[model samples]
Structures are given as C-alpha cells and as structure tokens.
Target: MKNTSALFIIDDVIANQLLELDDEYIGYQVLHEESFYKHLLDVQEFPVIDEYSNKESHKALLVIRSWQEVREILKEVQKEKNINAWKRLFPCQLYADGAYGEDTIIQNLSCAERLLIRAVQEQKYVMFYC
Candidate 1:
C-alpha cells in the first residue's frame, strides 16, 4: 500500500474536538505523500510524538506542531536551489497515478504554507497526521 499523510492548521477548539473523536476524519486537511515531510520538508521531529504510545496506528497518527516551526521550515525549504530534487521526489505521476489520491508535494506544501499563514494570523497550531 502507498503511504500518505495530511497536514492541518486549526485552532485549539478543533484540535480538541478531533482528539476527542474516534479518529473518524479531519477537516481542512492538506494531503501529501509520506516522503513529503521526510525528504522535501526535512522535518526531524513531530509535535506530540511523545504523547502517544502507538507510533504506528491503523487509524491515524496525530501530531501537533507549532505554526512558527512549520513556517520556518517552509522558508528554509524554499531556499533549496535544486528544482530537480523536488521533481524527483514528487514526480507528477505520483499524484496522477492515484496511488493515494494526493496532490503533488509542492502543491500540498503550498496549501500547508497558506494554512500556516492563516494559523499565524489567527494564533493557531499546525497538526500533522499520517
């Protein structure tokens, strides 16, 4: 099976509600491949990683991250001079093939960045789930 992930920027209210739910679904979620975070984004750690026992969940692995950190990471990622690297990691066919029905890494990163901007303006946090 293909690995997929999603990023969400939400206020405390929604985050709390999602945590209370039975892992049904989440809203305002920008979907991407798992490598989007590891390769492109280069995220070394995820918030709330220590809060959960099961790192591998059949439902969804939820982790909350700071918007500031996300924005900073995006800023650094955008500084990458090699466009080919992005293309290599996020080939168009990845999304077109419908393996997980996700957007290209760049597309989802843009969406996630926009969400981070909104989160910063609204004083919120970015939540990640895989």
Candidate 2:
C-alpha cells in the first residue's frame, strides 16, 4: 500500500516541497486519463486530497499541457472503467484518504479526477503527480 495519489499544485517546485510533497507534476495525469476498460487496471489514482499527502520531498514540474490537451486527456479518462470503479468504490471520496484495499493502494487517488475537472473548466494547466 504505497502512498500513491495525485493533485494540483502552484507550478512551483519550491512551494510543492514546502508543503512536504514529492513528485509535483502537470499533465493529463495518466491515472486520471480514462480508458475503455481495456489494458488498464490498478489500485491507484483518486480521492481529492490536496492537503494530505505523505511524501515529504516533493514538488517539480514534470509535465506541461495546454488547456486543449488537458481536456483531451481527461476525455480519455472518462471512458476508462477503472477510473469510474475507483469513484464507485469510494462514494465518500475522502474515505479514500489513508485508505488501502489492494496491493497497490494510493491514498486520495480520486483527487486527480477532481483536479482534472477543475483544470478543464478553468481552462488552465495544473500541476499533478502520484
């Protein structure tokens, strides 16, 4: 049960570190990137946690994408069954915080999904990592 999760950041590595985080990134967030229930299944990526990560050496710009790109990737995730299953498993998303069920458990995995939605709606690229 590794502390796997994703979220939005200020696009500043230093800030990410100050918050006691690791692997600050930006992009579609593959875990959040949906698929059609094929070639993808894992216990990671979800639960909107921007203030509760365990990583202590974090924050860095890993990927950058335009609003258009972000939307496209998010659209892909919308088709993936794994992503939906995660949400269904955690109706109360926050329950996912500090939660673990499978060999590959990631706390707050749903956060990536929420972050993607917000980024798309705002038409802005957000920093994320897991």
Candidate 3:
C-alpha cells in the first residue's frame, strides 16, 4: 500500500463493529489510491486521521465520529474556493509519456466529492486505508 490510499464509507453499524472487534473489513470503495489527501490539505480542512490497528495490520482512518462532522467536511470540499485551490495546485499540463497528469488529480477530487456527498446523504462513516 505504498504511495496509495483508499477510502471506505461504511454504515455506522459496520464501523462500530470494526471498531469493537479492532479489525478491518471491506466496505463500499469510495476512493482507491486516488491521493486526494494533498488536495484535501490544499483546501485546509483535512479531517483528523487515526490509526486503526489489528495485530500487525495498521491503517490510517479518518476520524469522523459523527455524520455532522462528515457534512461539515463535505461542505468545505464542495466549496468553489476549495475547488479552485485544487485547480491551481494541479494546473493542466501535458506529459510526453502520457502518464497520469494534472487533470487526474482534479478528476480524483471531483470523484471524491461526489462519493462523499453520497456518503453524507446515506449517513455513512468513512475510513481511510493508507
């Protein structure tokens, strides 16, 4: 899982279960290795992250204790100002190798926003696997 991150949005019950059991389980794959954290940092509303541990396995999990916190974070992510900040951070550019370019980062941000909106609407909690 080097240089990659995954976001899982699960039902509150499932989140509680995982927390209680101190284990990890697969859930709705919202973002997989999209590297949205940089963009989140640019927006200056990065969610607090905590470590989720089970035996030798450990992953960074977004510290969201309530749906209201999710909504608050979502609001910051959806703001035009924040979106523009991402745009400035990832200005469009071309690469001769045609690998993942600046546009990919922006696209990832947009996709994350959509999924997080859905999570808010569905009242789910998020866990970041890093």
Candidate 4:
C-alpha cells in the first residue's frame, strides 16, 4: 500500500454500503498520486482528509460529486495525453522534471483515466478519497 489515493465514481448503494462496512472495499490502483490530489485541490473539491492513517483513510474521507463536475474536469484532464496537463493543474516541485519522468506517470494512467471517465459518464458520484 504505497499510495492510498483513490479516484472513483460509484453508485449510491455501494457508497452507502461502504459507509457502513468499509472492510469490504477493494482498492483501486492509484493512477497518479500527487497530481491527482493537486487536481482535486485545484478544483476546490476538498472533503475531510484523514492524514494519520494515510492509506486507510479512504472511508473517512469519502466524498461525492455530481457527475457534471466530474465530467468537466475529466474532459479537461483527458486532453493533453501527457503530464503537462497535470502539471498545469498542479505545481512544478511535485513531479520530476523531464520528458521521461513525466511520460512515465502519464502513460501508466491510460486505463485508470478511461475507467474513471466511464464512471463519470454513468452519472454516479465521482469521488477522490479513501
């Protein structure tokens, strides 16, 4: 469990279930670590973050967003096909500078980006949290 950041959109029933018994929650692979958090921050989509437990804080920090907002941000992020888009939303120091370093981050996230986009399009609550 190196990184705990989870970006997902789920139906209300699933959200409610997890709210009750989070032990059953299966983790999603973190697409981008710092950039994902920065993206949430840039969009002002903050919920309570549980800093102490770190990876285990997902249940405590659960937040729901309307699919419209999710769609808009996803659209903006999906454009660049590179970390340049993420860097534009975030800051310089968070990522290593150079094409190789940046592309490493961006290239691996294609599947995650697609899955998240699908979730958003389904009009579920898109979330970024534990």
Candidate 5:
C-alpha cells in the first residue's frame, strides 16, 4: 500500500477539525497562498512528494472559495511539473452559508474521505481539491 498525506488551504478552524477527526490516519499540513506560491517558485516545481513504494503519492488540497483560484494555478503547475496522475477532490456543497440542506459539508467531506481511502488502497495518486 502507498502512504498518503493531505495539504489544506482552509481556515484554521476547519483544518483543526479535520486534523482532530483523522489525526492518526491522515497526515495534515497547512497551505497558504503566499507560502504555496513561494514553495512552487523556490522548488521550480509543484508541491508533490513520493510516498510508499517510491511511487506517486496521494495529495489532497483543501481550499475555500476565496482561494479557489488555486485550482487553475495548480493545473498549470501539474502541466509544468509533468504530473500525469492526480485526482481533484472538492466540497460538494458550500459550508459557509446556512444551507442546512441534505447535502451537508460533512457529508461531502465523508464521501471524499471514502474515495481517498479507496484510492490509497488501490495505490493510486490522487489530488483532492476542496
């Protein structure tokens, strides 16, 4: 099996909650626009790492609407860095609004988590964006 980690650009409150929920299983790291940009420039590459088996590692990116621009930026990074395999995961619903509808943010998170788990089990490198 391949090991995996997650990078989040979300607010501290949500990031902290996610960390608490899966501290042992999922590796968590914070990602900010400035820092991420700096890293990308410094490394002259996208923020990616090799996990188990020295193969492509699963990477998940969590960001809010304010930072949604990163989505397109990452696509460029992927192309420049030659990342052929990656999955983009995102929140199916908006959590900021009081849309206490059936499609809750938690449900989306759970579903994404499940998909990630499966991808890891299958030794696939996935890039989840939310």
Candidate 6:
C-alpha cells in the first residue's frame, strides 16, 4: 500500500472515520469556523509542503463545505487525481450534513463516482478540486 499524508477539512464524523481507518495517518480536523479559517491560511502558506514523507506517501487536502458542495468537490478532486476503483490506500471523505444522513452521503458519492469515470474517459483534470 502506498503511504500518503492527507489534509482533511471536514466535520467531526468524517474526520473520526478517517482516523479510525488509519492510525498512522497524520491530519488535522477543522470542525469549527475559526479552525476552518485557520486551515485556509495554512493551506495558502502551504506549511506541510516541506514536511518529510516517503516517496510512496501521498498528500491530499480535503475541504468539506456543505453536503452538496462537498460531493461536487470530491468528484472534481478524484478527476484531477485520475483515481479509480475507490481503493482504500487513499481513503478520504468530504462529509457534511445532508437531509437523509448516510443515505444522502452515499448518493452524493455515486455522483462523484460518475464524474470520476467521465474524467478518466476524457483524461481531463477538474481544476476546482485542486
């Protein structure tokens, strides 16, 4: 498995799941408004860019806005990365509050999958995800 460092700007639920999936993976959880702003500042400066990591390690930045927007963003990011098969190696979810809880989240994910497939077919990178 490729080891990667990922940055997630998500809610408590998604962040908890990600941590549970991999204890070794280091990341920050921005669940509050102040923390979110702080995270944006950090991203602009790119503090983690110089941090040490292995060649196989991958770094990702996940920003979870609203439930609807998060899915759109994820689809874009997946397209940009050209990722397929939904491998657990780089598992990260941008989750937010939707009407139907997990069901809505899953539906959103399906949309992201479709976008991913289209991106793969066209060999195009979605710019907003970056």
Top candidate by TM-score: 3
lDDT of 5 at 127: 37
Across residues 20-105, which tens digit of lDDT does each residue of candidate 2 receive? Answer: 43534432343343331122222344434323344323422333345566676666554234554444322343335554454233
In candidate 2, residue 106 scores what lDDT?
Answer: 39
In candidate 5, which residue pairs clash?
Answer: 87-127, 89-128, 89-129
lDDT (C-alpha) at residue 45 in model 6: 16
* lDDT (10s digit) by residue, model 4, range 16-70: 5445644544343332344333333212121112222243433334444566765
Each model's TM-score?
A: 0.38, 0.37, 0.41, 0.41, 0.23, 0.26
lDDT for each residue of candidate 1 in 1-130, tens digit (9 for 90 to 100): 1123433433455455456766554332322334222223222222222222134444444566566765555454551353333333222333343433223444444544455566556555555554
lDDT of 6 by residue, 1-130 (tens): 1221222333444434434544443333322345333432111111121222232234334322333443454554543243332322223332211322444434444544554444344433321111
* Candidate 6 accuracy as lDDT: 0.33
Between candidates 2 and 5, the one scoring higher on TM-score is 2
Q: Which scores better on lDDT, 3 or 5?
A: 3
Query: Would you give me the overall lDDT of model 5?
Result: 0.33
Task: Provide the lDDT at 41 for model 3.
Answer: 21
| Candidate 6: residue pairs that collide | 3-57, 4-58
- Per-residue CA lDDT of model 3 for 1-130, tens digit only, reads 3222333444455446446644344332322324322222211111111111221133343333455666766655643456554332221221123443445545556655665566568665554442
Error of 1 at 8 (Å): 6.4
Order of models, best TM-score first = 3, 4, 1, 2, 6, 5
Q: Indicate whether candidate 3 or candidate 5 has the larger TM-score.
A: 3
RMSD of each: 13.0, 13.6, 12.4, 11.5, 17.1, 15.5
Relative to the unseen true structure, what is the Cα RMSD of model 4?
Answer: 11.5
